[model samples]
Target: MSMFDNISVVKKANVYFDGKCVSHTVQFPDGTRKSVGVILPSTLTFNTGAPEIMEGVAGSCRVRLAGETEWKTYHAGESFDVPANSSFDIEVMGDPYHYVCHFG
Candidate 1:
């Protein structure tokens, strides 16, 4: 799916880590929500309230989920799952990492 259809988007952006990460909430007609965002070149940790699937849209990133030791790389068209109430470390270098976050 190259684009989303019949969705409502929040006008304000969700800024984090001093704006290194930014996203906007997109709500679907079925009441599901997702976020489309880009992470600037940096290494950051994010805590999740709900379980999420991080789908890579552009560029690439190295991620280490909570309790993990090894780092795995995800490029465009790849995805990674994060558990609820958990955290993950993401490292994005050179180009910004674009992603769509599917929340549950």
Candidate 2:
């Protein structure tokens, strides 16, 4: 099979919340395979056993791990990884918060 054969374009979503706009593009591969997600200027909390990479392009935000009361800050040109099975929350803290997320 071609490298991208098993990949299917799932859907695209745009969301607006708390005066911020986010765009999401989801892609799914074959059986039990990991999916890819692209997000723009969005805060997310993961509830499954998937690893993710979040990158900041502009503005800033904070990430709070599950069961933790502290937040780790991220700014423009910064990136962080979310371990498998971990729960985390993010919030945009500065103007024109822009970020990208890739999950699998």
Candidate 3:
């Protein structure tokens, strides 16, 4: 079995992307903590199921799914998710961003 196989409670962690910040908590199954930050220039896209990716918005950026119609704006204190089997991308409208991610 895994080291965390017996874990039951959820663990929380904080991540900062660009200027945006978010807290993630994972429970049961795999007692892991994930934190992430992301910045995009123009537009960037990724395939789904690649992994669980989180991006924190710093300045001005837009996030949306590939071939989708709408783009959501992300700013400081905002968080976005990259779901499994879903395509997503981010467009940077300002400067380069930074994200602090921790996973265990």
Candidate 4:
């Protein structure tokens, strides 16, 4: 039950947020899709239709979960969970934020 046991990569993706972010969609053997992206320095809010695990692969950012008053910072090898049908804010403080979003 290890991660990356049967993965497929789709190398190219459309630039999102007017070029502030770019992501490649990848798939797992179980048919789950993940978006691996690099986000430029900016504050952005995203809505999740399903539960998601956002993993930080490089750089850092501060995130405020929906209905939360405090902001948490995540760096390389860190991850956070976002609830389904909720929104969260991410602030990139002058560095690109690289992440992989796994949906469930």
CA lDDT, every model vs. true structure:
0.98, 0.62, 0.53, 0.88
Every model: Cα RMSD to truth: 0.5, 5.9, 9.2, 2.6
Q: How are the candidates ranked when ordered by lDDT, highest leading? A: 1, 4, 2, 3
Q: Which lDDT tens digits does candidate 4 get at residues 1-104?
A: 11455689887795877888788888988788898888999988888899999999889999999999999999979999999999999999877998988899
Model 1 CA deviation exceeding 4 Å by range: none
Shift in Å, residue 13, candidate 2: 2.1
When summed lDDT is taken over every stretch of 10 residues in candidate 1, the lowest stretch is 1-10
C-alpha-based local distance difference test score of model 2: 0.62
Per-model TM-score on C-alpha atoms: 0.98, 0.57, 0.50, 0.87
Q: Give candidate 1's error at residue 26 in angstroms.
A: 0.2
Q: Give the Å shift of residue 95 in candidate 3.
A: 0.8
Tens-digit lDDT track for model 1 on 30-57? 9999999999999999999999999999
lDDT (tens digit, per residue) of candidate 2 on 1-104: 11335454546555545435555444445443333222335676655377877777667878887888999998867888888888788776436556656666
Worst 10 residues of 4 by lDDT: 1-10
The TM-score ranking, best first, is: 1, 4, 2, 3
